[model samples]
Target: MSISPLKETIPKLDPPNNTSLHPPPSPSTHRTLRRLKSAHVLGSSVSQPSLISQQHKQSLNRNFSPTRKVTNPPPGAHTRTRSNSDANVMSPALSSPISRRPQMKRASPVEGSTLDRLIRDGPTEGDLERGLESMRLKILDQGVKSDGDGMSSLRIYVWLVLLNAPVLETDEYLSLIHRGASPAYSKIRNDTFRTLATDPLFRRRVSEASLIRLLNAVAWKLHDAKGERSEVQMRLTNTANIYGSPELQHATPAKGRSRATTLTNDGSDAGKSEPGTYVQGMNVLAAPFLYAARSEAEAFIAFHQFITTECPGYVRGAMDGVHKGLALVDKVLAIVDPKLSLYLIGKGMNAELYAFPSVLTLCACTPPLPEVLRLWDFLFAYGAHLNILCIVAQLVILRNSILNSPSPTKILRSFPPLQADIVKEVTLTLVKKIPDDIYAEIVIHAK
Candidate 1:
């Protein structure tokens, strides 16, 4: 049971010579040696596959994980240390190359949008007559809304286009204003103070000084035209007297009066004024233009064009067109709503007695500036003369109330805030119902 001493055994070997017995391996021998080394390596890997697999997996994770890097990083990039578990459970989004950004807004549709059509067609594109007519149809069909400030800008542009007001250079407008106050300055000043006093839209948007300046400029323009026309007529007459020719006499007669006889683009005479004066209620007619227009000059141009071309008679001698419009209101009412018309007539409530303000101001006498804006869109699109029928339509709508009210005149005096769309519908129907003769008169009444 006693332990014996362990003996160390060493393998005996012969002493080696300095020179190699085997010469350097040939190329084939070298290839075989490489294959044997590869096989030895393969055998070693196969024998220890689990250890190799773990190292391979670690190498893959170190290469793929954003949290680890072997080389210098780019400027502004921070070095962050992440736990092994976090690196293993990294989010794909964090590894993405591109950063996230806000999505862009898609544009709204334009097919049925009136504003889009107006912008697309513009004032100068397409055939003048056809474009205007098509635009009118679009306006009536779609009903333009003042889409806030953008719509306000659109309103002025559309009004200018509808009125056929030419755009003048800023210097020209400035020179016009430089001429100082017109002969009607006193009246313009008085009216400017009172213009749209009740309407918050006008009061908030327009200044009285602006109104005065614009009105005075327009008055001066009208005054200058009248004076020039008179001088021309006098020269023509003098020439005719000196020549004593019958042909000259006929020509002199041709220059008798230059009042516009019709409400069309071809205004009869843009120079001479029959009344030869700017009168009251013009401030109201000019209110919408000033309210919608971006500047005083724009308002002036549109208002001037409106009065001189579209409805000259409204501001001319005795405002004959306004009187005519009032009469037409009664006639139209009598035709469309005889029961209401006769009822009003029975109460001594003719248009002259009640609708003077409505006719005079082109129905701008009504309140709620937004509603007035809508009404004006129709008036500007169609003939302003249609306003008579619009008045009649109002009467028809309130027929039952007028018939039942003890004081119909008071009720009719200041029409309720206009429902432009409803009035448009009623007037359109009245167009078909009225007699041909009455319709013809309606067409020419505002001339």
Candidate 2:
């Protein structure tokens, strides 16, 4: 997949078993989060005015944070060039009025329990001890009945408890983790200990000092973009990174696209229903992912929060319309091509939004940054394809459950925000049941 292959056909690489991990950025993909950083590579400007960076070919990590309030796109900017060298593409443009260019040059640890739990410590020693104890009990209980599927099973149990907290007792759920209710409950306890310590929600209840203290446990990841090799530092191993063919990267989103006008989406027309399908509240086009109703709302709120409080530069990126337009294209493409879908999940790895510190790790509750860098290496290899496909299929897969699931709350707890594992699992399975020709059919348009 050479960048020079201006107009080339994408190959079909379908096999079967689709195993996904970390469903955060449910509405976005590994690329969406990672793309926010500075890519050293340069593309042949599209059309709109864009800025040219001298830092092309730099395969390093660069964080571009804006400090001002989010503003409109820069008018009359130079167009961003597209290259055939990356899975997801990038170029330079105006900075957001509120862009803070916070160079988190210092790589932190990955902050989740499932993969690499780098503990930075959250508030009281008691909190830490309790959280750890809670996880330990969870592991033992789950492990008691099986050949070691405890932790995985416990993950589901946690999701269910969190999503459908019928009794709404945090301690009960916390107790579930504290006691040996399920196999590997201990592991969940350990992981949750770290997560709860750093969890913003947890911190909110705790003192501000505790929240800041807990963040130290937070880690960072690396992103591979179409930038200069020296610029986009690669961190985190055994994860998804989106620096494949540049043309594919830029084209994957195929700008000028719009959100779903095909049917009643979001809460707007959820009232209307057809025979086989009913309307759900999920916002299928949220940047991080197409999610169940509440998730969509959460994501929208989170994104707006990010746009306002975090990355003002995003508006600048949006100005090129690359962020918003391309994102919309990516969303549309996700539906059109499974491979191009947006779910970019990394199981048991740091779920950093991008592979770089600049992108600002954005998964709901996953591993930290440093460990996430490891994951991006793999992500960048095939991330472009996975970026579009995963997100789209996730929507398709969830559309039914989201729209009509008996227990809608379970949607959030049932799984992590991202669904990379599902993609790997489904693709591998499809390979066997599906003939080569069928894959070819999908791949043809996947480009």
Candidate 3:
């Protein structure tokens, strides 16, 4: 089915003339900087904003240094001041405002294990794919372990391998964050606070500042890409007009109308607006990466790889990929469990009404955050398209309750908090039941 483009105008995000690419930090940031400087780790201080709160610092410590025991400071600890000389003698981790957390310990693979060798040796693209298949099977049979709070020792590296995410430098991500907020800054701020808002596990571990920074950095990247694409399109349009191409003439908007207001054969506005630079559900999508990643930059790399490659359509104008995925959810559910599918449909319930968040966030919206992480382990392992079948599996698991309920919508309004193991089991079974054609559609629905 053809999806109509959204009618919104793309906002220009070019910085003002006086604004430098690397603007000086604000007063609060300066205080943070001084704190880092005092800790004698000036080099690492530039990696993140200095304004990281005390709570966030502890959370980071907990997530990355899973084995370290964090002790509380004595009362009136905030009132004490340290001299530069005294700070120099203190350990960097103890003195720095944001402690340098250690990377999670890698599981010691068997001496000759294929997965260990692949990870240690860094396989080529073809070899990596083969390695990932082995890894996928291992993950399916024995799931990755995580702290109850969703922090995993090895999950981020696995996700990076599965996504084939490039090795991004800390400076590269810092540069984006240093660019300050993008045109979507206000929109991003609005959604960041609400992301995984009700989940204590997520709330405690991820700082609002960190989430805002990651999303804003992503917005800037998207904004820059959109600008480049627009420039190329404009150049092509100009060249076409100069050549007197009939197709160009037919496609050009009228003098009185902007391209965004132009109508197409589908009777819908043929707008220039691409997928949004910052959409609402993106905060949810980015949350898991931040929760899983060892650092913001690591999270940025994985999250960027995911949106740009795995599911570009999901983030595009009107989230056409997500809508497509939703429709597929209904179809897959019918094939796997026709009784539940028809019962829900007869009650005027459909995937569109209930599965939007699940579709858009890859089931991250449902929580018990650790379970979400486990489910994601599977998604990143197999194929993300399997999430469609996973959603169907959720329905199948809940079939008894839904079929019996007079109002089935209440049961489906939210999936019973994600049961990753059972969901994966049902999903694999459902995968076998899907016809080849429908399964093919499931595979590419997010693309």
In terms of TM-score, the best-performing candidate is 3
lDDT of 3: 0.63
- lDDT for each residue of candidate 3 in 1-447, tens digit (9 for 90 to 100): 011111112222122122212221222321222233211121233544432233223422111111222356678553211101000011123221111111112233333544333444443343432344456555665666454565654576667766656545455665676677678888888888889989997877677777887887898888898788767766765665567555445554564234322322123332333656887789999999987765676688788878987788798767888999999999888877788788889989989999999999999999888889888987876667778888888888888898889998888787888988888877766655777678768767776
Q: Which ten residues in a row have the lowest lDDT in candidate 3?
A: 81-90
List candidate 1 stretches off by more than 4 Å: 1-114, 120-125, 148-151, 245-273
Ranking of models by lDDT: 3, 1, 2
**Ten-residue region with minimum lDDT total, candidate 2:** 274-283
Error of 3 at 205 (Å): 0.9
lDDT for position 35 in model 1: 22
Query: Candidate 2: deviation at residue 186, Å?
Result: 37
Better of 2 and 3 by TM-score: 3
**Model 3 clash pairs?**
275-316, 275-317
Indicate the worst ten consecutive residues by lDDT in candidate 1: 1-10
Of the pair 1 and 3, which is ahead by TM-score? 3
The CA lDDT of each predicted structure is 0.58, 0.24, 0.63
Task: Report the Cα lDDT for candidate 1.
Answer: 0.58
List residue ranges in candidate 3 displaced over 4 A: 1-111, 114-117, 123-126, 246-273
Tell me the number of clashing residue pairs for each predicted model. 0, 153, 2
